[model samples]
Target chain A: MENKVLMKGNEAIAEAAIRAGCRHYFGYPITPQTELAAYMAKRMPKINGTFLQAESEIAAINMVYGVAGTGKRVMTSSSSPGISLKQEGISYIAGSDLPCLIVNVQRGGPGLGGIQPSQSDYFQATKGGGHGDYHLIVLAPSSVQEMADLTALGFDLADKYRMPAMLLADGTIGQMMEPVVLAEEKEISKVNKPWAVTGTEMKREHNIINSLYLAPDELEQKNFERYEKYKVVEENEARYESFMMEDAEYCVVAFGIAARVSKNAVVAARKQGIKVGLIRPITLWPFPKKAIADAASKVKGFLSVELSTGQMIEDIKLAENCKVPVELCCRVGGMIMSPDEVLGSIKKLMGGAK
Target chain B: MTTEILIAGFGGQGILFAGKFLANKGLLEGRNLSWLPSYGPEMRGGTANCSVVLSDDPIGSPIVTNPDVLIVMNLPSLDKYENAVKTGGTIFVDSTLIKRKVNRTDVNVCYIPATALAQQNDMPTLANMIMIGKVIGECQVVKMDGMEDAVNKIVSARHAALKEINLKALKIGNDYKE
Candidate 1:
């Protein structure tokens, strides 16, 4: 029987990761997502897993990098500002094709912005956050349940693609309490980590894991291989949700908390006869462009609603290629837009009682 | 049907815990539900609130822009959210903390001296629990059996010593016919 147990989103991530066969964790405390680190610190000792609160996010992410190089399912989570510090490490992980999970329970940003929930990291998440030309498989989770579900899926996808995977959640989803069914403890035998580094003690073909390929041709070949894997990821992993779009002329496109808010606005607008729907992108990197482009063909316009002022709307407009009138409704600096606010934007777009 | 509620109060008021109980009840009843709370600096000395969405269909947004119900344990919450409740929604005010009326006739308003009632039960910490009882009593959004199961699970996991008090708080709420 699926029983309800109230748990914070941060706690959910820790519990979920552990259940997903992650016995290694490294993180630094940051507002909105600190509870996750704290929970792991307390629980990892009991589970015989290693949990380390690094001096900084960069250090933590590098810690993830070192562990991941050996192929142990590992994770490191932080808020927006701290996530920025980990960009270098993330780029290294991407370049090395290391499989790891990075949870960014996003807060308002640009610089130590407030610690409120904000979906401002749309571009950072989708555009291969760090420098370099590689991309991380980014998944945006809307609920605490997804906080668990996606963390598990992230590990699977990371292993499947041999790349870094991210859970792009907002601070609200991190801090909230919700009933999440703890996934069954995974069997020890199920941990598939043939790619791990357990002390080169294989005594068979010395395992040399190094990112430094001084030979130009060899580095080029490795880059091409990683690119091919990314190509596969993009082609197969585009995920999104469409609501009431079959008969609707106007729709809102959003993700994460913004998607949740827009969904209500669309539902409420529909009640007023405005024929509205919502398109929520689940995977932002592979970006459900076909869905949004297809939506452009069916709908008169798309309203890009988010917690950041016009950041993700850029992607929607780019995807639609101006085929449809793509308007934007947004909130920034940790402020959340109300349903009334969203509905007002939708109504005005539909030429309703604005 | 989907029932959306926003429970707001101070951090120590157990507003989040009560919201969790309601969301848990919905889950126990096999309903789709979520509970989300304020984060970061707003969580410090500021008013903390949680949005609880209980729906028959899979919940679209855990974040309710305009809640169908608003339960305020303090005055700041009432002032901040009073104008945002749906026209036909319900507003429950803790008269022990909030003195002003919501002043909107479109919404059903209930005045429960929640803190006083908890004090009457000899445990001030049960104020939020009492409020939870009253909310479930007034709305009856979840089955009584579901609520019982939820309360037993939550109180036992949360504060084992206060489990009996929380159960009694629910009983007082269940017994409130009005």
Candidate 2:
């Protein structure tokens, strides 16, 4: 009894969070992701949830921190520029080991780039966007269904690790409509937040949630502990999808919408008897290294198709051990790469390698 | 077996709904599917479009650059996407809007009078549904029954009463032997 419903990725995410037991949403209206805020504004009141349109992205993220500090499920979202505004707040929340979901429906950037979908925030999302020694568990969703499912997972992982997690989607996925089989949500138990400062009575002592460890040794221990947690995440949370990778000679490495287009490109290439395949990373931070590395033995080379000035190319290069050459098909600034363009790149790589 | 399609037209022409219907039929048929759209400032009283990919395997990219099928509801969309149709692919143009035929000989062209059919049925709003039916008929990407289910699923929330008209529109076009 799977019931399919067609919905935009942004609205789907808002509804999914509600189903996932989120009681509070704090955010600003940013293009390519405004539907989420609008959905929240319309639905939050009905569910007795607080949907606060904060004056700035900074204010919005801090509101999320305050709500999450109370041990309630909470979230915030924005596009790339707005996300940049919230970075400092993101760092503080991460430093305090708060459990919250931050959704970034990324658009082109470096500055106020454009509203078109782009994956330019890869490095910023995975490798710490703010000033600090911290990391956010980044989940890359390639479709509207994932947009809903991953927002739920984002909250779950955040609560599990007692750190902030991010749903790193792009504008294309956000605005798109698709038939999504919305899953039945898991129950949210009254969570344990011993770190919360609800107030200290005469019987209990005062509690503190701070990231300021002035002592270098204490800070180092916290950093090391975070690294240990990240290692656990890398081991257990690395996710990717493979398409016809078994017994294939050529593979394309892509994420988000680029992955979707490459899927078609690979199919077209395969129809031409080229034996092409694809590897899609769902978790960009963990890098899906094991999967990509495993691909090296089966495929001659990996084609890194991205919507940037070749940002994810660095990750592809790092994942391989000189066993296979990684090629780049880069596009940026609100420009979408055609499947033929990707196939052309693949053909070039295959011609040179074979 | 993957079937990728692009549904393009004006903002009010039901292009997004058409793509969603195609993707819904994929779901009904137990296939992996995806429906991706293009919208923003450009959708305000302007042209809009979406790419819907239906396949037996897990759909990789939903953004279709070169689609196996392109359903053009208007002229701008035909111009925007005519070159992107795969060689030997099928192009379904609304005879009401696109007066000239697609000149390419490598692909098959379906000249369905979607607007004409809608107006003749006295239900002008179902033109997009007519186009969807034409897409299903010409491409056979999804079954008509499956498309009916898709329509029910798509229109249930907002326009439940409009389903019958849409289904009738589909039956008219799907039954058209042309």
Candidate 3:
């Protein structure tokens, strides 16, 4: 389709959203992710789409909520601190069952940590950042191409489930540039907004978009219904990639940029006859528990590589049912772990020292 | 084959742009590639750098600790990254800006007066492209024919005339004797 183009990951996500029929983008500027909003600001006008830089991240997510309720494709993006501001809005979006996209190009963290690449927000993203008994459909992109592919996928998933979807990316993936073959533009006409609050004139009754339920039983029923949908999502939406698992003694479990580095470590280890493989989770919310479990049954041990103090390790342990020994090799506070370091960890798992 | 490259220089020296050009060239060759920059404060007139990976197979990591090739424009970059180049790897230093000799005898070192060449050729602020040209020519990381097309796509339409100058700079580095 002559669609291959060299672009930064953040810019690709913005372009992909446009192609995915997302005509509205409301975001406050933040490092590592500012390019995405900037691209939308420049291109949205020409395409007759809406791109508004809100006063704050909170306002931006609410803007997404408003546009999404009208059954239009809308999205907002932020970095770590800014994402925290949008959490309340995101929770409300989930509670109201509005379909939208939220992109979190994470940097170092607790509070304005640093402007370097980090995956510390793994828990915040997959465990529902805002709160309540809800889960976000989280998709993590390892490369610039995946950054684009997953943005379109996030929109599709959000629409299909009537829930908010997130593209969980780190600073490295957000700022990096690579070749990408973009997706075909989706026809906005096909997106049905029948339940939207687009004003019911004389044809039907009023459509109210509200999350507040005063009655206890009504709220309980709504929660049950949402959980039912979540179960369906978990069953059908688990996405992952398994690399060189056949006849391997141990496995490395990682996601996003960490997974990218872990793959190099695995490749290097294989060259030395270490028998190490990699299991990458593309969908962080569904968490790809089965992939890890299958590998756990065959492999002797597992190593969790991350850019944090090791949050995803808990998930790996639970997924593996704590059957195999799972160790962590990580670098925290926006620091990236080198391939050699990860390779050393894999070698240790193989019961040897390099 | 896989080529992991690290390009570093001062903030205004076009280090990121050099990485981008090579990355685009790699893409044009239908190879898997990734370009990751060291963003934030390090880019605030300090030592800015980026990692570029080009491979026949899918790239595992966009970041590299020991690069197969290292391109440095300033003295600080050379000092910081000289030891990071792998044994038998190539290190391209900007002789115009750096006067000190390479400390390592194990790796291949190419000292090109890129800044001086750019200043002398009436094309200032093109040392990065010159180093890129030299690297591509020396390392054979990507084809030299892909340079012009990559420049055309990267440079804005308003600066279309710069394409010719960029190609000329690239040729200077590619055809360098030393």
Candidate 4:
């Protein structure tokens, strides 16, 4: 706490990524996330790291793919439309089982939407943005401190699971400044990557990193093996935060900025004698299903608050197995739901439950 | 206690900088705080605003929809956010730039000729600092003791001279009357 400094969430993510031993950064300019690339552009050179502003989002993700093949921690970031452009490379990287970080400081978008905070990319990020059955370990940070912590965590998770990880943030968190106690600078020891395409030195079989499989059965076996790894990740790595859930009758489920807003509403509702709490999912891909399922037994209903038109509500419903009534409170097209608006929703949920 | 402050002005009026300064003061005091700016094409040459929340407890939403303290440096901002302040909240207006009187009678309003004061003090760009000084003096959200330290933390070493001028402007606004 003594060493806390005020930093924008985007800058915190960049600094934490550097601290996490990421040496290669490839990105194109995009609003709400441009500060991240600008930070990397300024710092990467002094540290002798690679910072390339690729010609396009596709080029940037492919650059991430190349560096990831070398088994080094590399990352790229963008807003919504740009993130859509990187999906193809993301699928390829996942197919190769490469470890890397991807950051989406999302803005409003179906296509070229306004540059305002939005979580409309929730489905795209959590349910596979690219083709093929693959998952990115998605981490959502609701605050600037989490922004830094999750960037480091994303790299570690990616390395552990041998897959790509994402920091799914929004424009509000990306642009906001807050006090953050950054992780201390420690000696970063490289993780042993035997599958890395570093030269073999003629001592062992050559290592090949590729997504292309000519044989259908070989690809099927590879997909099966990857799913096995994913199963372990889902079991062990699902993370969430429960707030004021003790003795609560109604629950609000949200992530990223929506979770922050929902927290306020929960507090207000509690003041008004409504036993409502919050469940904030930190890992979106491994959606915190267990938490919802467990809370379903106690809570009367669940309110899914989001910055999109009720995208994460489906996940909440599925998680709770439709045992309890689930409702959606949301705003779309880069608009955020105010705390009062969310409080109104919470009160409505309470009334409907009665 | 939580104080949500909304500062609005023209793009180059140092609205974000003032909010950052206030956020840093809260940070230095070890209080939980968040500073969020309205970022977009409008920031090029149009209205800009920032929301700063300083709190003793953990802050939930960073956005300040109904601010406890509202500071408007221009007329449009005053017109837009005048009704958005909490009923018992305070509004600080830069009278030098905005000529209209506040219409709301439910909230406390302070009109400071911040730009004129900054000009008379030979620091024209220090108007934002002046308004911030008034905010600190009136709201008492942050103490005046660690201002020098806060300025040192925000201003880079290369612009060391700004520390002196900014402090002077803050003192001017803090001591301003009528």
TM-score of each: 0.91, 0.89, 0.97, 0.98
lDDT of 2 by residue, A31-68 (tens): 99999999999999998999999999999999998888
How well is each residue in A97-198 modelled by candidate 1, as lDDT tens digits?
788999999988788888889998888887877987788989998778888988898998988888899999998788776668888978633546665667
lDDT of 3 by residue, A37-141 (tens): 999999999999999999999899999999989988999999999999999999999999999999999999889999888999999999988878899999999
Each candidate: what lDDT?
A: 0.84, 0.86, 0.91, 0.94
Q: Which ten residues in a row have the lowest lDDT in candidate 1 chain A?
A: A187-196
Model 4 spans with C-alpha error above 4 angstroms: none
- Ranked candidates (TM-score, high to low): 4, 3, 1, 2
**lDDT of candidate 4 vs native?**
0.94
True contacts kept of each: 0.78, 0.68, 0.88, 0.93
Q: lDDT rank, highest first?
A: 4, 3, 2, 1
TM-score of chain A of 4: 0.98
Candidate number 2, chain A TM-score: 0.97
Which 10 successive residues of model 1 chain B have the least lDDT summed? B37-46
Best by TM-score: 4
lDDT-wise, the better of 1 and 2 is 2
Best by DockQ: 4
lDDT of 2 at A336: 82
Across residues B1-178, which tens digit of lDDT does each residue of candidate 4 receive?
A: 9999999999988999999999999998999999999998866469999999999999999999999999999999999999999999999999999999999999999999999999998999889999999989999979999899989988999999899999998899899997
Query: Candidate 3 has which clashing residue pairs, if any?
Result: none
* Model 1 C-alpha lDDT versus the unseen true structure: 0.84
Q: What lDDT does candidate 4 reach at residue A257?
A: 95
